[model samples]
Target: MARILLRSGKSPFDPVSPQQVIQQNLIATNTGNLLFGDAVHKMLLTPGTEITPNRYQVDPADADRINDEYDVFVVPLANAFRPSFKRHLNDLSALIERLRIPVVVFGVGGQAGTDYGTDHLAPIEQEVRRFCSAVLERSPSIGVRGEFTEKYLNGLGYSEVDVIGCPSMFMHGRELRVDKRAASLEDTAGLAVNVSYDSGNIPGSVIGNGLINRLADAALERYSDLVYVAQELKDMELLYWGDVSEAAGTSSPAPLTRSHPLLREDRTRLFHDSSTWIDALRERDFAFGTRIHGNVAALLAGTPAVVLCHDSRTLELCRYFDIPHRLVADLADETDLAGLPAQLYEEADFSAMVDGHGERFDRLVSFMDRHGLDHVHKPGGDDGAAFESELETVDLHPGMSSWKGGHDGGLGYRLAWLREADTRSRVRQSASDKRVRELTSRVGSLERQIEESAVLAKELAKANKRLEQLVKEVRSSPYRRLRRFAGRLVRRVRSRS
Candidate 1:
C-alpha cells in the first residue's frame, strides 16, 4: 500500500471538541481551510493508498521521516500566494526541497483586488517562485485556483501550472447537482447567511458597501430559521465563549460581536469540522455569503448557494467552478436591502455549475495522475465509499452555538467543556505564575551581580589612579633625578673616548 501525507489541521473524521479545535487552531485560523482539506482527503482515499493528515506541519527536519514513511506529500491550499502567508509558504518550500518523495499542490491561489491585478502580489513573487520551483522539482505540475493565479504564475515563468479550481467542489467525484426548491426567496423555509467581517475595511469589498451585512440584517428580521454561519476563529470564540476579548483585535460592527442580534438570539453557529458544517447547510433552503467555502459547503450539501464576490480569490474560484455569484459592487446602487436576498435567490442559476462539474473534476483527476498520484475518482477506485463509511461511524460534534439559548444535551456538553477549559486555564496560569516568580528571583540575582561588578569596577579604577600617581611621584623624586644625571655623564665620557 502506498502511503500519502496530506497537509491538514485534522482529519475530517476526527471527532474533536470545539474548545480543542479553537485552542489548537485545528481549523487553521479559518474554518474554510477544512472544506478543501476534507475534500482532498476523501478524494485521495483510493484502494491500496493510505492517507494520514500531517497536522499542518512543514518542518524541514520532518522531511526524512516523511520520505521514509510516505510515498507522496499532498498540499491543498487557499490564497497561500499572498504576503501574509509567505512565511508558511517558504517553510513548506524548504521542507519540499529536502523531501525525496513527490509533492503535489492543489488549488493554491494568489489573492488580490477584485480587478484581478497582480501588482499586489509583487512582494511574494520570489517566495511564490521558490515554492513552485520546489514543487515542480518533485512533481510534473502545480495546480492553481483560477485564471488570475494561472496568469500570475505564467508571468513568473512557470509553464507547468494548471487551473484545477478547488477540490471542495469535486468532493462528490464529478457528479454535482443543485436544484432551486423555491421559486421566490419569500417562499423559502430556511436561509443560511455568511459574511466576512474584515472585508468591510477593504476598499471595494461587498461588506465595505454594507450589502452583505444589510442583507444579513434583513434575513435576521424576516426568517425565523435564519442561521448566520461564521468562519473566523474569533467569531467562533464569540459563539462559544459569549464574549471575545477586545484584545482579539476584531473591529467594530455589533453584528460581529457578541451583542449582535444573531449571536444574542442564538442564531449564530460555528462548525469545528466541515462535515457538520455541510450537514447543517444541507437542511437550509438557500445559502448566500461573502465566504466562498461557506457557500461551497451549501453547494456540497446540494443546497442552492450564491457567492457575494468581494475579492479576486472568491471571484476567480466562483468563475472557475461556475458557481452562482454576484459582485457586491454591482448591487451598490440598490436601496431595497430587505428584498435583495429574495431577488438574488430568484436570479441565481446553477445549471452551468452543475452540468460542467464533471469536466472540472476530470481536470483535477488528470492533474493528480500527471503528478503520479492516485485518487478515488479514477477508474476501479472505490469513489470514496470507504472514506464516507468511516466518516459516518465517527460521532462528530455539531455546530457550536451560544450557551445562553438552549437547554439540550449540547448545552450541557458545552458547559462541561467550559468548566474543563476554565480548570485548564487556571492550572496553566498557576504554572505561569510560578515561572514568573522564578524568573523574577533570577533577575534579582543578576541585578545583585551587576551591582557587585559595578563596585569592583569603581575600586579598580581608583586603584589604577593611585598607581599612576605613585609612579609619577617616584619618577619626579630627587633620587630618580640624580640617577638620570649619572647616566647622562657616563654616556658623554664614552662619546669623548
Candidate 2:
C-alpha cells in the first residue's frame, strides 16, 4: 500500500451538534475530511493533530511506521498552513524540511491573507513562503488551488506554483456546464453561507441579520427559498437560519448535514452518499454560496451556481475554473438577491468562461512544465526523468498508467489504500467525545453532592436548636437553689443515721 501524508484540519465524523457546529468548522461538506494525495498509490493517511501539528494528516508517531517502504510521501495544505493551525503548520513545515523522499501536492490551497504591496498577509506571507520553499525544495512544484494563491506565492518569490484549483472541483471533469432553466424561475434561490464559529469571526462567511434582511428584501422581488449550505459541519449557517426562521415563525427551515466528519470512509460510501446533496438541490432554480466546492457540486449536477467569495480560495477557484461568481463585498445596499439573477444563471457560456481561464490554466501548465511533470505518465520511460525522480517520493502518480485507466496496479491496489487509511477517525472522535462526557458527568456528580449537603445542614441546625434550649434552661432556672437543697437533705439523713 502507498503511504501518504494528508492534511485535514477538521475531522469529518465530528459530532454536528448545534452548539458544536457553532463552535467549530472542522467539516467542509464538499472537501469532506481529506486533502490532496489522491494520486498516491495505496494511499495511507498520516493525519496531523495539535500535539504534532506537522503531522496533522500523517501523525509523527506513524513516522517510522510510514517513513519507509512506501512509494512516496504526500504533503497537502489548506490555505498553505495559515495560522489557523499554527503549531501543526510548523510541524508539517519541519517534516517537509527533513523529508528524505519526493512528494507532489494536488490542488494545494495557498494563503494570501494580505497583499504583498502592504503588510496585509506579511507575517503569514513569511510562513507561506517558508512552506513553499520547503515544498519546492523537496517536491518539484506545489499545486495551488487558484490564481490568487499563485499571485500571493509569486509575490513572496515563489516561482513554481501550479493553479490546480480544488481536487473536489476537478472531481467531476475539466469543464463546467450551466444547466438550462425555464422563464421566471422564482422561489428557487439558494444561498450557501459559511457560518463557522470555530474560525475566528470570519466576516466573509457570515450572513447575519442585516445581511439576511437585505437578502429578504431581495427575495421579495423574485427569490423563494434561501438555502444555506455548510462548508464545514461546524458551520453555524444553519443555526443562523434557525434563529431567522424562529424569528420569522416560518414553518420550513434550511436543511442541515451535521453528520459529516473528518475521517476517511470507503470510497463507494464516501462519493455516493455525498451525492445526495445534488438530489436535495435538484428543484432549486439557482444557487450561490461561499463554499467553493458547494457551488462546484451544484455545477457538477448541471445546476447553475454563483459563488460568494469568502477568501482567496473562493476567488481563486472561480477565476481559475472560469465559473460564474461575484465577490461578496461587491454586493451593495442596493444589491438584492431577489432581483433578476445575473446572466450567469442562463446563457453565460461556460465554454467561454473556461476559455476565459486562459491565463489561469497557463499557470497549471507552467507548474507541470516547471516540475517536468505531465497530467499522465507511465513508468519505464528513460526520458521521463521528472516522473521517475518524483515517483520515488509518492507510491502512486500519473506515472503508474494502465490501459484500463488506473485498473491495474493503481486501482488494484485500492484495497491496500483502504486497509491503511481505514483509520477509524470517528471512533477516535467518539472516544474523545466520551471522555468529554465523562468529565462533564463528574461535574454533574459534584453538583449532586453539593445538593445533598442541604440535608446534613438541616440536621446540624436541629442539633444547634436543642443546644440553645438547654443553655437557656440552665441559665433561667434556680440551679444553685436546687443543688443547696439536695446537699442539706444528704447531710440531715447522715446525722439522723
Candidate 3:
C-alpha cells in the first residue's frame, strides 16, 4: 500500500456559516484530504487504500502527520488550480517542494476556457504557476483534462503537460448497444432533462429562460414523458426555482422527483450518492445533461445522451468521448437542433476517444509509481482497493428517488402559462403599490378628522354638565325668587362701585 496525499483545494465547510465552516475545516485536519478527488481519484487511486493519514487542511503542521509515512502525493483538482481557496493550493505546493516528492494531477479542469488569456484568471494564474512550476521543477509529470487546460499549462511554459480528459468518462472499451426503434412510452415520447445548480459560471436566467427549455422540448417531441433529475440536494431547489419561476401561471409539468427519507435534516439529503439518480435514469430512453456527472450517469447506464455544452469541462468530456452535444449559445433557439434527434450519439463509439485518454491515465499511474507507491490497479495495487473502501464509508443513501406524479409529466405547455402568471404578478404588484398609497392617504385623513371630533365632543360634555349643576341649584332652592333678587343686588352693587 502506498502512503499518499490526496488533495481537493476547497474548504470542507459551508461558506455561509463561519462556525460550520470552521467545524468542517477542523474535520479535514483529522481526515487529511478526501479519499479521492472528485472525478479522477477513482480512476487510478484504486479502491482499498487510505490516500493520507490526515487530509483537507492547508496548514502544513496539520498535514505533517504523514511527512514520513507517505511515499507519493496525488493532487486532484478542477479547471484552474489557483489559490482561489485560502492559501490551500500554495500550501500544497510548498509541501511538494519541501519533500521533493513526485506529484501528479488527475484530469484537473477549471481554467476559464482556453479562449481567454491566463491574464483573465489574474492572481489565480500566478498562484497556479507558483505551485505547478515547483512540481515540474522537481521532474514530476502533470496531466490536465482538456485542450483548454493543456493550453493553459503550455502558456505557463511547462513542457510535460498532457490532455487526459475527465476520469468520469473512461474510454469504455465495450461497444454501446443502441436501440434504433427505441420507442418511448405509449402515445408520447419520454425526455430526460438533468438540472444543475453549479452551471460552471453560467447565468441563472440562461437556465431559467428558453435556452435549456428548447432542448427539453426537442427530447420531449419523441417521448410521452419528460422528467428532471437532480444529483446534489441544492440542485433540487434550483430546478423548481429556475423552472417554476419561469413556468409560473404557465401549465408547465415541471414537478420535482423525491427520494426516500425526505427529512429537512442537515447535509444528509444533499449528500445522497450519484448511484440513486443513475438507476433512475436507466428508466428513461434518452437524457440531456448540463452537469458533467449527469451525463456520466447516462453513459454508465449505457443510455443514449447529448451534452448541452456550456463551459470547458462539459465540452472537453463530450468531445473526448465523441458524444453528440450542443453549446448554450447554439441551443438557445429551436434551430439549434436543426436535424432534430440526429445529434444524439451512442456511448459505444468512443473507443478511439477512450484510447486517447490513456496517456493521461498513464501519467497518473506513473506519478504514483515514481514515489514508490503501488496503486491498487497495478499487479500489487492495494492502494486502489483501499481507496474504494473509503468511499463505501460515505453513505450514498439518496433519500426517496421516487416521489409523486407519474401521470402528468409533460409541463411544456404549462411553462407558457407560468410566463403569463409572472406577468400578471408584476402587474398586480404595481396595482397593489398604487392601492397602498391611496389607502394610506385615506387612513391618514380619517385619523385626523376623528381626532378633531373627539376634542369637540369633550368640550360639549363639559358645557352640558355645568348647565345641569346650575339648573339643580335653582330648582332645589324654594329660592327661584331669592336668586333673582340676588342677581339684581349684584347689579346695584356693581353700579354703586
Best by lDDT: 1
- Residue-level lDDT tens digits of model 3 in 1-497: 55566665232221222233233442232111221243334444554444542335556554355456765566665544533452767787767667645666666665443133345456676677877787677555676766766777787777777666655454221223334235323324444566543344433224445455445445544444655554443333322223333223333332332121111111112222333445565665676667566666666556667676666666776675566676665555557442344455433244553354455456545644664544454665553344445555654434333222236564533553464478579899999999999999999999999999999899999999999998988877868878888999999999999
Candidate ordering by lDDT (highest first): 1, 3, 2
TM-score of each: 0.80, 0.54, 0.57
| Ranking 1 against 3 by TM-score, winner | 1
Error of 2 at 265 (Å): 31
Per residue, candidate 2 scores C-alpha lDDT tens digits across 226-304 of 5444444323332222122222333321222221111111000112122344444555566655556556666656777
Query: What digit string (tens of lDDT, one per residue) describes model 1 on residues 161-198?
Result: 89999888887887788888868866346999988875
Instruction: Assess the local accuracy of residue 307 in candidate 1 as a C-alpha lDDT between 0 and 100.
Output: 94
If ranked by TM-score, best first, what sequence of candidates would result? 1, 3, 2
Candidate 3 segments exceeding 4 Å error: 8-48, 52-56, 82-88, 94-101, 113-119, 137-139, 171-191, 196-210, 217-224, 236-271, 335-373, 379-395, 399-497
Clashing pairs in 1: none
Off by over 4 Å in 2: 1-5, 8-56, 111-118, 188-213, 216-226, 235-273, 340-349, 354-497
